[model samples]
Target: MADDGPDEAGEPEGPDGAAGQPVTPDRLRAFSDGVFAIAATLLILEVKAPAADERVWHALRHEWPALAAYAVTFLVIGIAWIHHHNLFHQVRTVDRGMLLLNLGMLATISFLPLPTATLGGHLRGGDASAAAVFYSVSMAAASAWFTLFWHHLCRRPQLMLPAAREGASRARRNSLLGPVGYAAAALIAPLTPEGSLALSAALVVYFVVGRRAPATRTRVLAE
Candidate 1:
């Protein structure tokens, strides 16, 4: 009979000896990166101009709503990828649970382009309110999944590197900010479509520009 010990092969342990199958985050990250790329690529598909207009340039200019939608979805998904990198950086290994949560997040991410197109098409149409509601609801759901994923990572200290645990507390709380903003946008979407999207966009920009690690690392470390 073989003696089971801490250093045994095939029983690889995490930094904090968190119990789980020994799976690196690289494969998971690679898969997620592909999803993000596809979602971004799909955004441009809805930006086409309407058929047969006398003023070509003017017609092109009229497509601003589609362009705007593409830009907003692009930026939001870009931020999601950044957040994904930051998270997987800390989480050295993964188990079934991590994969499941990440899948949910990716599912929401993959669904973004559809609502983005819908919202853009309806922005200046009679369906604007309905479009705003649909778009905001989709964004809110995606935000929730992203927040849940980050919060799950924060809870598993054993899954994180020693240095990562320091920022875990703030990271958990910050993750919820995006979700709250999205939900607020959803609630107010019927009253004002443009205002709701503008608010959601502001939240996305604030999240990236405000909490960028280089500028804020020392503050978190000092705590």
Candidate 2:
């Protein structure tokens, strides 16, 4: 397969030419898409029906917070998956370290719904400390995984998409926000859990709603 270098369209070169060969990215992409689909489906399993009418109302009123958390995490995971897909689209081959990072990132992502449920449940129960700690730790772990993946990519820049230069820098900046916000949440978890959770929620909104200026992105890419 070493001699089967892909063409510009990511197709493998055949006896005829690169145009006739199947794209290696198809298999890898399919595998990654399967993992993402499973992860998204797993989120719904955490939802339980209310036992009483009052409970139903309570659940309805309270579900939004957890639902919001779920939305943020789901979309974030989706974005990362998309980014990963695009990255590998440009890559013709994978190495041991890259494979390891991909596996680890996928493993971490699979846990997102559990934490989202935990956050929603604890918040509704008024278990401020438990909820804050759970949510913060979950975000932190995901962020750390992202950081590890980005750092690894930086070390192995040749494996990345050619256009990933600006995108990678954007990823690095995005990666820092989660860890920093989660660390802050963790620090205040014991003393002011509600405050920490509020901060965390705010951070999530910022992540989803804000834009990274292109000028700064270009500068980072240049460096």
Candidate 3:
């Protein structure tokens, strides 16, 4: 009778020594948590406190634009982080390019507060052109980061989970919308400040509309 033992072929063992490589979701989770924490904390610094004034209404009125900008940027970043977390949760393996892509994404995330504050300052001061420019640039950088990261995942099928590809593609398109819209906005800034702001408004609508698509909505709900 033949004895059952290690194979002479020397194939690698599975996650539990069963068949294939291990999925390290924990490490991804831990790394994501840290990034999210840092990003969230950075958002607060963009939200300056209202000055003490003779009238509470006056103080709030002065700070309202900044507050609004801070809120919007914070929520957008939070949404991106959630999507990233979900995407990585399904991913099975990591590679060098994936690591670089993630680093680029993190780099963009770390810059969010600067542009948030820039938007806030310009909008509050009634410099529409500056606000539009800042907002557009920030959105463009963010979109580029998302595109690069997703491109890597899409190009390298082995790095992604089977169930996630369709959703990831949809999500990537959604992420790309911001930069494209902002690019349009920036182009119009020189000719029309109002038009540029209108473009910015269009970006918000695009974001909301993208989320409402049945498949993405359903997948988001499932998550």
Q: Estimate each model's TM-score.
A: 0.82, 0.69, 0.72
* Candidate 3 error regions (>4 Å): 1-25, 124-128, 166-171, 191-210, 213-223
lDDT for each of the candidates? 0.76, 0.65, 0.63
lDDT of each residue in 1-223, candidate 3, tens digit only = 1112222112236568654433254565577668767876787776556656457677667776567666666666766666576667666666555555677777777777887677667763557677667776776777577777776667665556677766666667656776787788778766665566556665665555645632253222222
Question: Whose lDDT is higher: candidate 1's or candidate 3's?
Answer: 1
lDDT of 1 by residue, 74-182 (tens): 9889878877777777775565567778888899999999999998899899888889888878888887876676666566566667778877788777778777888
| Candidate 2 C-alpha lDDT tens digits along 150-210 | 6666655665656664466656666777788888887888777667667776775665557
Worst 10 residues of 3 by lDDT: 1-10
The TM-score-based order of candidates, best leading, equals 1, 3, 2
Better candidate number, 1 or 3, judged by TM-score: 1
| Candidate 3 local Cα displacement, residue 170, angstroms | 4.5
With a 3 Å backbone cut-off (N, CA, C), the pairs that clash in candidate 1 are none
lDDT ranking, best first = 1, 2, 3
Indicate the residue-level lDDT of 119 in model 3.
66
Task: Tell me the deviation in Å of residue 22 in model 1.
Answer: 4.5
Candidate 2 segments whose C-alpha is farther than 4 A from its true place = 1-26, 50-59, 62-65, 89-92, 163-174, 212-223
